[model samples]
Target: MAEFDDILARAADGGRIEAEDALRLYTDAPFHALAEAANAARERVIGDDIVTYIIDRNINYTNVCTTACKFCAFYRAPKHDEGWTHDNAEVLRRCGEAVDLGATQVMLQGGHHPEFGVEYYEELFSAVKEQYPDLVIHSIGPSEIDHMSRVSGVEVDEAIKRIKAAGLDSIAGAGAEMLPERPRKAIAPLKEPGGRWLEIMEAAHVQGLESTATMMMGTGETNAERIEHLRMIRDVQDRTGGFRSFIPWTYQPENNHLKGRTQATALEYLRLLAVARLFFHNVTHLQSSWLTVGKAAGQLSMHLGVDDLGSIMLEENVISSAGARNQSKLGELIDLIRSGDRVPAQRNTVYERMSVHWTPEDDPSDDRVRSHFSTIVADLQQKA
Candidate 1:
């Protein structure tokens, strides 16, 4: 407990805690006590107020994937009957709906379908942007870039340039599970290497696109490896400062090739959250994953130094496809942040505030109501 307190003290002072201390925090620290200490550290940094979330939608445009990763349950093989591909019109429709409902950003993620090369994304993104000029297109990750490059016969840098030129505003940190080669291969052998993930991210950053850095935990990686993942992102961030946020989500074990045998505990997630706050001192924002850990754990995560509650995803299929059980309402989210003694604000893809929601009444009504209102307006217009 003394050691735990010492780590907490260091974090509160904005001092770096070593990897060994981080391991102890993950393995041995008592739950509520650790939460309290982490919250104390968080208060020192971001203060007791000002927790934030984004009004966005996660649009999975396709599920046809070539890389059959053992840990993923969201992707379907190319020939599988369950696989789906959303046409440009369908994708645009989703974006239009999101915009109509007041979503400021759309996370456009999909699998690495062999046929959907750079041209496919260019057309899809261009269409969405052409329709909704104000909507932020935060889409794709490094693995998709690598796969698209290989499939389209283009260099990684060139692929990034074309995608950004089309409409992609930022890279979603989806593909990075663990940065070390050994564990990453064990979990996702078919995906790109850790070095290549960083290299492409650097390439994209150089081409004037910033991205989020992420970690997928509880896939049997050692504590040292997890710290190393943080270090890798930290080193790159030191060089480029291109990463806007650091997000770590636990691996959900259900309906996947890796069954429900292994998962990160709630305590483990918080420990990592706290450590990430202390370690990645250069990274300005740290986001909590309510989608994977459930809303309660996500609320506790803010105390563990997460300033952002991630997206209030109006539509999500990836993590839900993996068996994550929690769904949050916008009102509930505001309450969660307020219960944590923080003000809740809605942000855009770039962390720009769209509005600060002070109470549950401040939340906009549900999308279904807005859709009904729109239908009424159209009918009245036709009658006139």
Candidate 2:
């Protein structure tokens, strides 16, 4: 285990962590030991005793997906009667609700609607920005861009430019269900190729659009594949440095096609978190998957290596449709961070500091700002 110890030492000293070392840590390192090393690395890389959260909402504009992945429960078949797409007015109304509850950012995600193309998103984004000039539209990802390019008969770079010019703030790194070819095919066979996703992201970065990278683990991917995911993202970040953060979350197993047989355990999640902190030395922030992993696990992640607890999501549907039951309010998020013995702060989409909670007096009095209390799906369905 000298190799493992050496890797740990390197991480503690703020040195780079290679994929082989990360694989060993994932396979052999004790849970607590890995957490300690990762926490130390976190302190060196970002800072100790400070955890960040953002106030945002996820707006799934459509449930109709042409490329229905085996691991997804949120997407409806394109011709399925259950399929629904939000109109511009409904989209704006949700944005208004999110802004009313203190969300500065909106993640405009959706399934790959076959009929919609680049111009569709351009008009939607332009309309959103026209109405709500302040709300940051961190919308769509590589999968949507590639799909729209094919539909609109334009190149990926042109689609990204059109969306950016139409007020798309940044790409919401969702299409990366898994980076490796084998598992990516197993889970999301019809989505864009792994290399194509990275190429599109790099192209977007080249055009001045920064985005985060995400990994949806479990669904039967191996430990080595997990490490490989980190390696791919690290290589990209090394080249473009456009990735703002790396957020890895476990797969949810509810209404999905892949059932619950291949779920990643909580211990495994923590191990990956620690390895991520050490492995992603070039990445600026590491966020927990509290929305999928639950609050206790999320709280534990900060001590393990996560510098950010993600968002107090004003609304979410992707993972929720796959059985994410956990929810929290802004005050509760502050308490979750405080319980971990770390200071809590409010951050924007780009990790900019918005507010910090030092004491009870500094807390917001409104406890009703819940993370998952309101959802666009429920509101739209109820109205329909």
Query: What's the lDDT for all of these models?
Result: 0.81, 0.89
Residue by residue across 1-384, what tens digits does model 1's lDDT show?
A: 766787767766777666667667766777676667666666776764678887777787888998998988888899898788878888888788888777788888989998988888888888988999888999889999998888899998889989898999999888999989999999888888999999999999898899999999888988888888988888888889999999999988877988966788887788889778877667878898988888889887877788899876777776665777677676677788888778888787777777887766676656342212222123333788
Q: Local error of candidate 1 at 21, Å? A: 4.5
What is residue 164's positional error in candidate 1, in angstroms? Answer: 0.8
- Checking candidate 2 for backbone clashes, the offending pairs are none
Best by TM-score: 2
Give candidate 1's root-mean-square deviation (CA, Å): 5.6
Listed in order, each prediction's TM-score against the native is: 0.90, 0.97
Q: Which ten residues in a row have the lowest lDDT in candidate 1?
A: 369-378
Please give the lDDT score at residue 359 for candidate 1: 69
Q: Candidate 2, residues 296-339: lDDT per residue as tens digits?
A: 99998998889999998888988887888888988888999988
Worst 10 residues of 2 by lDDT: 372-381
